[model samples]
Target: MTKHNSPLLGSHMSLSKSTNYLEGVVNETVNQNANTFMIFTGAPQNTKRVPVETFKIAEMNQLIDYHEIDKSKLVVHAPYLINLSNPVNETVWKFSIDFLLEEIKRCEALGIHLLVLHPGAYTKGSLEQGLQQLIKALDLVTDYESPVLIALETMSGKGTEVGGQLDDLAFVLQQVKKPERIGVCLDTCHLHDAGYQIQNWPEFKNNLKQLLPLDKVKVIHLNDSKNVCGAKKDRHENIGYGQIGFDTLVEIVWDEELTTVPKILETPYIDNLSPYKKEIKCLLSRSFNQDLK
Candidate 1:
């Protein structure tokens, strides 16, 4: 196996409807040869909460030891109900804070190093105001001893999403006192829909360099966009199966500068495992082969 210094390559896998059990999910990813993976800590809907289970924690540790997965390679996506930018009421905001705190606690117990979050929709207010709300909510959460880094994901600019642009995200990070705890998760589909020209390597590199430091970027959501550039849509297609194409991904995966950042696919699952395997093979081929030269 080629040992690349870059973060491990993998996809976000789903556990059952229950957030309490993660053993099967971890095992499935390991069986798929994934050294790194992402999972949602709870159900996607707004109702119901699943408390973390003890056995799942034990299984997670066992898998990590047995598979020798680096503790830093695992990531957990917070639940969908969390809207850091929501200005509805104090109760809602409090709920969001509690949800995130619980998520951090669970991740800490499991030794997961990254938590990817969507920078919430602002609904009926200025983007700046919404950002302030997000910062406030984050500030209220107590810190954990886990090495986990909280990554705010870029959005597709649909509705009132706060982190659609690099500037918006940068603003939030700047306001937050604990800079070390804050990082970025760049979603390819969202970036494309946000009007970033990622097809060209030089342009891509320049854009990223100008917006945020490469080191501040901790995670990459490797998905293709069903919508065109600047469409402000969040539809995700399989790798190379949508508008972004395989060549563009090749450029991204082989970039020496971004090799240290972990990349996880959020693509729709195909009927069988072939699609995931094929995508991984494609990424590996592009990274190691000289055909692109």
Candidate 2:
């Protein structure tokens, strides 16, 4: 039997102009010996996409099954250019909502369970209005009929983006019309940059207890931060190189509460996937050692 306790560790696979994005993700992730991974449905900035035909969907599912890939652990990252919180730009806001709806439909088509989405930037509005707009947009776009869960990502506190704060994300969860279809993805880099100090796991535990149920945390981005604590910058360094550092990053991923959650690396990709391969080995080695003890 496959071990139920092993973490679903992997990195986001690039999907540049590939005719086979879904199969590419499965092949690359399985090659890394990772149990799970993340991918964008299309180009993150543009709406251009590979046409999803009946054969494509069938092939994608067959490929995943052939690799013994766990569908629930597979994550579909929503495009980056969406701005559901843009209160001043009605055109952008409308597009964001529509784009989001389409993303969910794509997830459904691919049979992927979780969709990771940045909650979006406020652009030109108060934090209150920004959050309200996010809530409103979510309410508009959510579909109770779809099985896909939208996992709202924590942001680096840069600019006017929502979800830098845990409560900000929780509030959206509380207000959204379909709470059952929504969850959270905590990015370690964003958490540190947003000033959450999750490296201090005990305090982080306390914070997690205060903020939301641990089960509601559907995903974790395990990147280290390139900036200092409370810096509000979103730059990502490789696993051990930045502020989160080696020991803490290892410990964070191995924590029992997060072990079952899918942990993905959105780190700066270096040549030939060596960085992620090494990071996956490093983190899992520590975890295996801890299990032996």
Candidate 3:
């Protein structure tokens, strides 16, 4: 086995209903020897949420503390159904706001502080209008007192997605009333799909620093893309098995400045089993496992 120097590395663990949801996720993280992880408060596709109280939060915390996982880096992702960028439907827009607030409350209950969210799609309206609406929605959502910070994810330019560009995120940050409650979750796959040539890390980092504060980057979805740069399709490939090769990914993951930010894997599973343990091991050892597919 390769000895490792771990960064704040982890993957998105599923909330298993078969066992204690909270404890189950935490155990998966520990099993992978990961120090931090991300999960949805409920299923990511819909609004169906089990009550937080029943998730065995106390036992889960014990497990987390026992494993020495950093609670602050543990993230809860908002559901896919909530689109804060919806421009035409007022009802959907309001639902998005309400649902996100409720997710924050859930995160508070779980004692997790970071919530990763996709900036959402316009669907039927112009990009500018969608951004304005998104900024408005965030202003309302962040007005309340909460320890949970919403980390807006960079999106693939798929369909009407509003956050594919750094300019879009920068605009939202500038316009939102509560910047303190907002942070950014950079996705390597999304950045590549949306045409940011991140293989040249120095150039990309320099550009990102100009647009967004480095401190505002709270989480990174360290995925490799199934599609090429400028593809605009959001397909995630397993690390080293995708277009973004292993060395580039290792460089990004071990960048000195981002050591504190949790790097998450949202890679595709192989044979219905998680590839995270193998992937995480490969990353930590700084070795490319060519057999990982």
Candidate 4:
């Protein structure tokens, strides 16, 4: 659920690298004066997670309250290796399903209600078959009943990755038994890299309304791409420093169709967290200036 009062903006803060995983993620967000962001429960490429103790949960909730960030609107990115579309290896496929199902439970436990997932690649099968498997996995996870909203992320179309096309995401949702349990998180870099022009938010919104309604888009990975549109590159650059110019990025955040959804930065990291702070400052200042006009 989005808050219409302000633009929900924040970045992906790393827990693995932080000295204090739980509190550090929040502190980093507060350091940038951002209200919303995404986190990998563990490393996205590896299936490892820090054991969440009771104290961590209480401390995290305290910080969330102190910072005034809503828990429901928070987003979690699933691991990179969890691939539901692996048609060749049954074991890997099963692991993907199990990890995802467990991921929902973990989110529920922590009171984080939204989880973003990459619809996996079709490693050894056709796109059609891969989508079917993906849908099946989603159905199983949400089969019983779960409050955690699983958001399938838009991909960069790298290699045989399953969900670069908006239509592909829509199709997968159409087949899910519990459609209400799922949502979509559109990544700006992925959208541009997958051949859609980032400047053309109007057309994109029109298409979204026709098939996957804007209401179903709960989160946006606000990023600038290092590569040009249609380059199939997944590189993320600091906002205003990449192919997505600062002015265009301003236009992106101000787009009315996207105003209500939460926007997150998956931008490159600066060791001291200076880069994120600067990016957040840039977004707020640019948008504030637009209000004066």
Candidate 5:
């Protein structure tokens, strides 16, 4: 059995739909005995946002403090509607930039510093054009100085998504004007789907380091894929039941380089119930739950 340096383990908790919203998020994190968590300020699919004051920040902070949850690792995900790579339409691209900027402001006000964002799809344009547009959008949004850091999430290459490959992300990082405000969020399922051999840690790490630096990986989405490697589908399964097996995921969770980085589970629910409590327990115990399904 291997031991971790008390890694930050948590899941994507709800912020808007629950009875207590933000407080419920903190409570849910505590329920699972997690040290950090992620949330969307509103719904993930919509642009509609409620006033930040209504989030009950004071109450949420008190709950976080009481539970000794690491506030620095708390994350907020941008709405999926934001597409920074919409090269075909200027209107859509501008809207995406504005929405992302607003989300960053919201995160800053809430005292959260890390924001996870999908790099977005090109749809009707070439990958090169999409990458250019994405770089431009990021530059525009990060022009202002804020404590909030935007983490570009690795995509599953399901469609015309921009971040399915490391070269694309590396190019964006190299071209982006505000490097200090940008970072990366590595999702295990996405990497596996995009055809990266994540199960082979050494080879994958060597290849990854050749293009992207480990320090830029601010967060990790600890998910198991329902599809096999190189499937290009983004379906997520429970920890041990999916293609990316339990032992591999456990290895990632305890990886020395990512020890301080936050690991968030976005696994599918079983029987309309969250499997995080059990999943987190299993990961901490450094063993797989045979009956997790």
Candidate 6:
């Protein structure tokens, strides 16, 4: 076991389901012993699109001050409708760009340092062409400030999604002139589904080191996969409840190289927030007593 703390331990909590609003959610998460946290700024479903309001920013700042959550420990998930790789007409592209820009601005205003986004799927074009489109779309967006890091999440490589592979993600980073403005949010479940052996500690670490530098890894989505490795399925199961066993999580919790990053659980919280608390506690209890050989 390695005495690791690179990623501050936390879980994703839904603000829409809570009665206490964003501030209450932060308080509850902090009370639960989370040093880091993730939240959806808008409704997850495609109901009425809610505009990002200024009051939300004020509330978020208040919560941050109350909880003392370092601005770096907080991350916001972008809306589900954004797809930079969409090969649709210019109208769809324009809508996605606007939506993503607004999300970036909201995150920036609230003092959140990172915003995790699913690099959109290419609907009808070749994968290569779609990737180029993604780069182009990112280039066109101007709402994000230099301080805000737009994190492109690794996908499950199920279809025409442009970010399943490390090379694909690197390609996007390479194309964008603002390299410092881009970062990565690695999801364990997605990596597993994309055929990475996350359960093997040495392999996992080496793979990441080869694919990306530690500095570029700004956030981690610590999820267990409901699907088998290489299945390209996107189902997220409770930690240790899916194909990703408890041993794998033990390795992750104790890994020395990742101790400083923000590892937020994206697990299913169907049984209220109790399951999330349990998951965080479980990881915290791991023995980070020695280095991995």
Local distance difference test, candidate 2: 0.81
Off by over 4 Å in 4: 1-5, 16-18, 270-274, 287-293
Assess the local accuracy of residue 41 in candidate 3 as a C-alpha lDDT between 0 and 100: 77
Instruction: Report every candidate's CA lDDT.
Output: 0.77, 0.81, 0.89, 0.80, 0.89, 0.76
Worst 10 residues of 1 by lDDT: 284-293
TM-score of each: 0.88, 0.91, 0.97, 0.91, 0.96, 0.88
Over the stretch 155-234, how does candidate 3's per-residue lDDT look in tens digits? 98889999999999988988899998999999999999999999999899999999989999999999999999999998
- lDDT (10s digit) by residue, model 5, range 1-293: 11235678999987774558788888878778788899988878887788999988998989987777778899999999999998999998999998888898899899999999999989999899999999999999888789999999999998899999978888899999998888999999999999998999778888889987889999999999999899999999899888999999999888887788999999998999999999999998898888887
> Model 6 — TM-score against the truth?
0.88
Which residue runs does candidate 1 get wrong by more than 4 Å?
Answer: 1-7, 17-21, 142-146, 272-274, 287-293
TM-score of 5: 0.96
Model 3 segments more than 4 A misplaced: 1-5
lDDT per residue as tens, model 1, 194-279: 98888886787787777677788988898888989999988998777789988887777667787777788888766654355567
Which of candidates 1 and 3 reaches a greater lDDT? 3
Among these predictions, the greatest TM-score belongs to 3
Residue lDDT tens for model 6, 1-293: 11223348788776663455566667767766777788877775453544555235677666766666676768888887888887766787788888888778777666776888888888888788778878888887743554778889998999878788888887888778677878899898998999888888687777777766778888889888899999998899887778887778767766777776788888876645457666776677763222110
The whole-model C-alpha lDDT of candidate 6 against the native structure comes to: 0.76
Model 6, position 44, has a per-residue lDDT of 52
Against the true structure, candidate 3 reaches a TM-score of 0.97
Q: What would the per-residue lDDT of candidate 4 be over residues 1-293, giving only the tens digit for each residue?
A: 22335567888877654447667777778778888878777778887676655326687789988777887778888888899888777898999999988787777777788889889998878899899889888887787587889889999999999988999999988889888988898988898899987676677678678887778998888888899888897998778767766777777676777776778887877564446667777787784222210
How many residue pairs clash in model 4? 1
Better of 3 and 5 by TM-score: 3
Residue 268, candidate 1: C-alpha displacement in angstroms: 1.2
